[model samples]
Target: MSLPVPPGPQYADKQFYINRGYHQIPKLRLSMDRIVKETVGLRPFRPSGPRIEAEQLGSKTIVHNYGHGGSGWSLSWGTGNMARNLVMATPERKIALLGCGTVGIATARLLQESGCEVTIYTKDVPPNVTSNLATGTWSPASRVCDPAVAKPEFRGVWEDATRYSFRRFQFLLGLNDIACWTDEYSVRNEVPTASEHSAGGEVYEIPGLIPERVRLGKKEHPFAADFVTRRSNLMFNIPSYLHYHLQDFLAFGGKVKIHEIKKLEDIDALPEKVVVNCMGLGAKPIFNDDELIPVSGQLSCLIPQSDIQYKLSTEGANFIARKDGIYLGSNGIVGNWDTTPSKEQTEKVVGILQEVMKNMRG
Candidate 1:
């Protein structure tokens, strides 16, 4: 019922930031590093929060845990635990996990940790699933659910899942080259507000939706922008993180079978007693979930630059430097359903990222 207090603004000192020498990194451009790859991934988004309940069919229990939308990786660990507990309750020691993307793999491991034997049935494994192509920021609410239609109680579910996953990801911060890392963000003007800022959910009232934001003096910030807001954001380098999860799952006696189930009848054929549906977008056709939409997203990867440890967010796109490479992206199209990369969009993103990098160097 009370007004929210905003962070106090600090004046940007031109001389203070300029003298810091944070801008020492050489200019990075799209042309400088060859484009190693360009990838497109359709986020399995259900405007509603992920399907985390169960269905009973002829003595079989199928717990639906997919449809996380774009927040699959960000919310994986928490949802994994959610589905794991559901299966644990059924006294079913053998579990079948559908889909092997971030959500599926995470859920598979969680079931294993719960003393259940998990057999993953999927069309593709890590670094191959659509999850591998994500520009995976630990942004728990990025299209996780359409807050407009979400019930008031959904906020509680989101808060618990986000906070739980946040803690779980922290445990991976410095291990295995730590696929999870933070990067400095250079703002062109005022910091952009997240999309979920005004969805009328109680989660909006929670603090730390993003890491603490600090105003960078003109010289202190590494970028060329006159006004900059620096913040540390949790980023998951998809390729490396996927590998880590796969290896971890395999090390723990989990089994994976390369197969895709097209309909409900296919459930009867799996080796496990209970199933956790992490099929993501596949749930739409398989389970007839008309609410699920494939939000098409694309990212272009260039050569890696170890010196670059920052990200830049402009009006329509973002540029990030990851362990694998610098990523340039994207123009989102909802309901488009096309996964093919757009040459025009790709060129425009390159311009946006290259212009920012050039300005920073200047």
Candidate 2:
């Protein structure tokens, strides 16, 4: 029951075990007693797609770079480069970068490498930022933009960012767990319908950019499902990844100032005439972007297991094994701003995985 190796870069690498048959399935202990913590993150979603263009605000030229939705981490390097190019066109050598989250840090690092002085002004840092709460998967198109409202030209921007980011992430592998590849399994009772596949909404795909999903025979895997498909993709260990980037930025002479920007006037007061906005969801009130909304996502983590190396996705739940814990989450609720952890939601998510592990054939 060995599966046919999918034709892709990952398959070409024998280390991925693309053509290998299954061994004994490792028993996964998933129970409420193992629950460690619950956290929430608000994705900065813009129905019109991410705003990466520049705008004029009084005496300052603000290069807008926020509103990335769930793709902040996946597309960070790409969008960061785009934002850097925008700033390079200006004559200002000293720049003020807003926000200290994933996007902001990436943008600041790029700006620094381009020979520009960067100073970050933010209300919070890692572990307190929204990016820290992310599940850390490479989801470049997750709720990026609404199909009905996005312009025709936006597709090209999305594709370009996705491709550029994918290439950049490859260089960071094997560096203190900043980023690495992980096998993801999608298990289901029946073949997924087209609509079910598109349940996440309009997706902009880049063909051949990642390994193709290969269906595994019943004996090839141990998941309790009628069908199982596997694909290898990159994921970030959010804590260490962010810490590495922040440390790099500081070591490279980048400056950080803890300040809150409440209005346009606050931005105008900055000494740097050129500014890059990586404020994520905070851009809504300060920049007066009505289209920006908060998409709430919650995760419940369990005690980490050394053998749980692969990610899993069922109909309504997802599991990612990070160094911190085994994270469990479901499709988040749109337009929800409450960041409070939900006990009931945690129970539901953990219960689903508990049932799946309990039914494992191995």
Candidate 3:
């Protein structure tokens, strides 16, 4: 057997490469890389399950369902289910919904299903709205909190949220802009493979798993290690999706009123006695709710790069996505709340991307 040639030092931590006469030759790198994995856990709801109890808030008339953090979209369907139960006991014909984001839309739809005329009173509509600003990935696990700590009375709330959103999206699986269920591959640092005893199949040693892009692969394709790709979905086009949702709402005889509430007295002015709040990131001043705080996040959109359909992230402060454009940014950067990319940061990301592209280009 031929001995593996001893190679010279090059990039520290990188394996050395040697050629006919060249020593420490740089190895071929790939433009594609893995981005850091995010545990998309929803924000934990505070101790105030019902700041206004059911009986106190006019249970026979009012239903409060709001304060969902980032997972608002993901948990909307389920949260709506619980809220619908409130009206189930009552025979109310009209209901008022605060906020017109994903949560509001879903709750309004659920209310309409119960033969109730739903009015969405919000300062903004869809498309030109905050819901449209989301990346629209289909991970419905977060946005609320760890449901265990919720009041025992709210035990069924969390489960209802997960099940409702899951089944709802399943029903709208192939809808137009609502959800662009495409192939997304999430590559990451090497990790231990799952054991067959737990996996119920042959344990494949996957050094790199294609995490996001959901695409059917060509037959007989080879991989570096045991890799698994699933149906990764994202809200590729938020504007279009919001339009579709708005149309659905209007079609169902739901009305949207644009009005901003400055104080608790504003909510008191609503004609409908029953109110379901679906305001996202708006609980700060609307109800004088001090628990809601803004944990700011920023992203950058670059020129489109179709060749890079996949997303990449290192650990933190580094994320690269190829969508309508090559989107890249870091949430971990300090003193950088500005959404507009700084020239220095832009150049730095561009350089990192350029190196990745050079190494991976076939």
Candidate 4:
């Protein structure tokens, strides 16, 4: 099926023909029997954007740094640097960092580098934290904030964090797959309208950081859809990525304690006078942040396929090929706090992929 070409110079520039040397890639195996595990994660989405400023809670200084939504993994390094700056302003060198996810570990390492003694207080560790379940990608603006509610200054913050994080991710490439680039293909019957692209409303965007998407011709790819576009973007193998950072933190003398903060008084009882809060969704309860909404997402992983190296996205579902497994996920359900894996959702997601695989053309 031939899709109607978009009528614009923008789309024209993105069009490209495949090279004669190009070869068809191996097809992904999609079946319910292949499913090995299913997990859910809650993205801490604040309509007003991420809180990065320092607030004094009684005698202790609390550096607020949560509510990144789905961009926590993507914007971690940059936001962590921002939180570290706030901690540096205070005279306290002994610091207590809350949560042990990507944000917490990133900030803890940054603080240690600045000569501050850091200890992580969290209820869970790697592979168990919310960030571990992320569909790891460079999506700094995904459900980040509500433009109507977010302050105008947030645009600058988002850009700075995105640019810095992009540069930092580049340095980790080829390092045992801690971070690497993968081709992402978007397949659909029609080109997405501008409004459809930003269904959650405009947040912030930084173009030219990743390669420009190239529209694929009918004979160029094996996808089932009429309209296909591919672009190279950075992806994190979360398991190894977090393990590497956690080891780095420990090697640098950083400490971690398995403690859950249930209230503000629990934070005040800490020995450290200055604290950095990286509690992604956990902030809703401890900080009483009613503005923080939980955007629940689930990922069903199949056994790892070494040949499937790229990512694919269709209408309602997406797939990410990682060293650990093939991750299958869909759009997050906003205001959903339930973390249990939905059998119905899993079957639907797998069914979509199975159909796509069935329709593949060589």
Taking all chains together, the TM-score of candidate 1 against the true structure is: 0.89
The predictions' CA RMSDs to the true structure, in order, are 4.1, 3.7, 10.5, 3.9
What lDDT score goes with residue 82 in model 4?
A: 95
Residue 204, candidate 3: Cα error in Å is 24
Decreasing TM-score order of the candidates: 2, 4, 1, 3
Residues 117-222 of candidate 2 have per-residue lDDT tens digits of 9999999998899999989988888788887899999999999899989998998999998899998888788787522432244377786888867876654577
**How would you encode candidate 3's per-residue C-alpha lDDT over 178-200 as one tens digit per residue?**
55555443222333233211111
In angstroms, how far off is 352's CA in candidate 4? 1.3
For model 1 the local lDDT of residue 327 reads 81
User: Candidate 3: global Cα-lDDT?
Assistant: 0.51
lDDT of 4: 0.85
Tell me which residue pairs clash in candidate 2.
none
For each candidate in turn, the TM-score is 0.89, 0.93, 0.66, 0.92
Off by over 4 Å in 4: 1-23, 194-202
Q: Which has the better TM-score: candidate 1, or candidate 4? A: 4
Better of 2 and 4 by TM-score: 2
TM-score for predicted model 3 compared with the true structure:
0.66
- The 0-to-1 C-alpha lDDT of every candidate, in the order given, reads 0.74, 0.85, 0.51, 0.85
- Spell out the clash pairs found in candidate 4: none
